[model samples]
Target: MVRISQQRVKCIGCNACVEAAPYRWRMSRKDGKCTLIQAVEKRGMFNILVTDDEYDANVDAAMHCPVNCIKIEQV
Candidate 1:
């Protein structure tokens, strides 16, 4: 499994993440911040678990994030 986590409060909405992984990330219309799709919010952070198929794209998302708010880990 792959875990994607984001410190959403720190997001700059640069769209790098969305560009890297459209399936797992998106631009929030309300705040212009990047939103983690299907994530559960907790303490200003968003998180989700996905299959390994999503790993590479999401890893790209994490690497492309200018603010370094996105993180990915294997579990």
Candidate 2:
């Protein structure tokens, strides 16, 4: 399985992720951080559930984030 995380503390409101992968990323109104488009919480972590087809886009979004706040892990 694959997962993505946005460390809000490192987010700088730069919309790179949104520009790269609007399908999987968006800006949060409360904090202006880039958040997963349809993120869900599990085990105290917020993550996006993506299909294989969406994987590359998500990874690209992570890579494009100027603040480097995004993280990806496989389990």
Candidate 3:
């Protein structure tokens, strides 16, 4: 499985993630940060269980991150 996490503090509000992958990313009105659309709370950051269909887009979103806040890992 693929797991995703976002470190909001490192986000630059570039909206790259949102533009690249609207299905899983969103811009926060309160902080203008990029957040996982359907993420669940983990230790601190938001986490999402991703499928193979979303892997590429999510990875593209992570790559588009200006501050490199998004993390994708296999589990």
Best by lDDT: 1
Which residue pairs in model 3 clash with each other?
none
| TM-score to native of every candidate shown | 0.97, 0.75, 0.87
Candidate 2, 12-72: lDDT as tens digits: 9899888878877778899887777667766645776555676777788878878777887
For candidate 1, the 10 contiguous residues with the lowest summed lDDT are 58-67
Candidate 1 lDDT over 2-75, as tens digits, reads: 99999999999999999999988899999999999999999988999999999999899899888899999999
Model 3 stretches with alpha carbons more than 4 Å out: none
Best by TM-score: 1
RMSD of 1: 0.5
Per-residue CA lDDT of model 3 for 5-55, tens digit only, reads 897777889999999889888889999888888888766688888887777
Clashing pairs in 2: none
Candidate 1: what lDDT? 0.93
The number of clashing residue pairs in model 1 is 0
| CA shift of 43, model 2, Å | 8.1
Any runs in candidate 2 off by more than 4 Å, and if so which? 42-45
